[model samples]
Target: MEDQFFELMCEKSSSESANTSGRTEEFLDSSANTVDISENEEERDKMTNFLQVIESYTDQEFRRNFRLNSSTARMLIDRYNTSSFYTNKEHGGLPKVGASKEIYILLSYMANTNTFREIANLFNMSKSSAWRILRRVVEWLLSIGHEYIQWPSASKVQDNMRKFKAMKNIPNFVGCIDCSHINIKAPVSNKHAYFKRKQFYSPQLQVVVDADKMFIDVFAGEPGSLHDSRILRRSSIYEKATDDVESKFPFNSFLLGDTAYGNSQGLISAFRENGFLTPA
Candidate 1:
C-alpha cells in the first residue's frame, strides 16, 4: 500500500508540471498576438485621425481653410498622381505620403501664413516633410501653369468682348488690367526696392482679367516701388503689343485700365478728375 501511494503522488507531480508548461506556452503566444494587434491598432488609429480631421470640415469650411473647393482640390490630386514627377522610380525614400494628403498640406501652407512646424503639427507630419511637399507641389504647378493660363483664343476673346460690352457698355473691351502688391519679407539685398506706399515691403502682381473675372494674363516680380505703367511696359503683353498690336488686339479689342496706366494703343484709361470735368 505504501508503494502505490508514492507512485500516485509522482504521477500527480508530473501532470502538474506538464500542465504548467502548456500554460506557459499559451501565455507567450497570447502575449505575442496581443502585441501585434496593439501595434496594428495604433497605426490604423493614426491614419484614421488624419482622415477624420479632413472629413469633419464642411464644404464651405474646406474652401475657407484651404482656399480651394473640395472638387478642385480632388482634381489637383488626380493630376498630381498621374504626373511623371510623382511616378518616377529613380527617386527612393521611405514610402511616400499619399498625394491627397500631401496636397492638403501644400494648400494649407499656401493658404495660411503658418510656418512649417505649425503646418506639420496640423497635418501630423514632420516639418521636413511639409517643406518637401510644398516645394514639390509648387514645382509641379509651375511646370503646368502655362497650359492653364494663356492668352485667350480669338473666339474666346470675342466672347469676352461681348460680355464686357453687355456688362458696362464698353465697346470691344476684352479685359481689365491692374497691378496689386503682394507682401513679402524685405530682401537681404536692396531692401528699400521692395518698399511700397502701404508702409510694407512687397512685389507687384499685374494681371488682366476678363468680364468673368478670370485671369487671362499675369505678370509678377516687379519691385513694389515701380509705377503701374512702368510695370506694364516691362511686361510681355507690352512687347507683343509693340510688335504686332493686331495679333493680340484683333477685332479692335482693348484692355481697360485706371488713371495710373494712362491711355495707350490696345488700352483705355479712365479720366482723372481735376475739378474741371462735366458729367458727360
Candidate 2:
C-alpha cells in the first residue's frame, strides 16, 4: 500500500509541472504578438500631451500669457515652419515638444522675463529643455530680425514726413531717439562695467522710433555705465549720420530726441530752458 501511494504522488507532481510550462509559453506568445503596438502607443501619448498643452487655454489667456494675440502667435509659428533655418526639422537633438508649445515657451520667456526653472514648472518640461527651446528660438528670431526691423527707404521716409511733423510742429522729423537701461544680474565677468549710476546693474538699450511708435532701429549691449552720448557715438546709425546725412536720409530730415542725445546734422534735441525742456 505505501509503494502505491508514493507512485501516485509522483504522477500528480509531473502533471502540475507540465501545466505550468504550458502557461509560460502562452504568455510569451501573447507578449510577442503585442510588441509592435508600443510605437503607436507612444505616438498617441505625444498627441495627447500636445493637445493638453493648448486645449485648455482660450485666446485671451494665450494673449495674456504670451503678450501677443493668438492670431499673431499662429502667424509666427507658420513663419517659423517656412523659414529655411527652422523648417519642420528638429536639429537640436532634443526630444520633440510640439511646435505650438515651443512658441508658447519662447513668448512666455520674453513677455514675462521668467526664470528658466519657473518656465519649466509652468510648461511641464525639464529646465534644460526650456533653456534649449529658448536658445534656439532666440537665435532664429535674431537671424530674421533684420527683415522686420529696418530703416525706412528714402521714399518711405518722405511719405512719413507729414505725419511726423503733425506731432509738435517739428518739421522734417524722421523719428525719436532715446536710451533706457535694462536691469540684469551681475555677470561673472565685468560686473563693475555693467553697474549704472542708478546703483543697479544693467545694459543700455537705444531705440529709434517713429512718431507712430514703430521701431525704426535699435542698438543694445552697451554697458549701463556708459553715457548716452558715448553709446550714440558707438552706434552704426551715428556712423552713417556722420558719414553723409544728406545722401542717407530725406533732405533736411532730422531725428527728435531729448537732451541726453547730442545735436548732430541728422539728430536734433528739443531746446532746454533753465533746468529742463518745457512740456509744450
- The lDDT per prediction is 0.67, 0.64
For each candidate, give its TM-score against the true structure.
0.78, 0.75
> What local lDDT does model 2 show for residue 244?
72
Quality of model 2 by C-alpha lDDT: 0.64
| CA error at residue 240 for candidate 1, angstroms | 1.2
Give the range where candidate 1 is weakest over 10 consecutive residues by summed lDDT. Answer: 2-11
**Over the stretch 101-186, how does candidate 2's per-residue lDDT look in tens digits?**
77777777677877665666677666656766765565555555454556778887876688877767778988888988877666
lDDT of predicted model 1: 0.67
Q: What CA RMSD would you report for each candidate?
A: 25.8, 25.4
Superposition TM-score, candidate 1 onto the true structure? 0.78
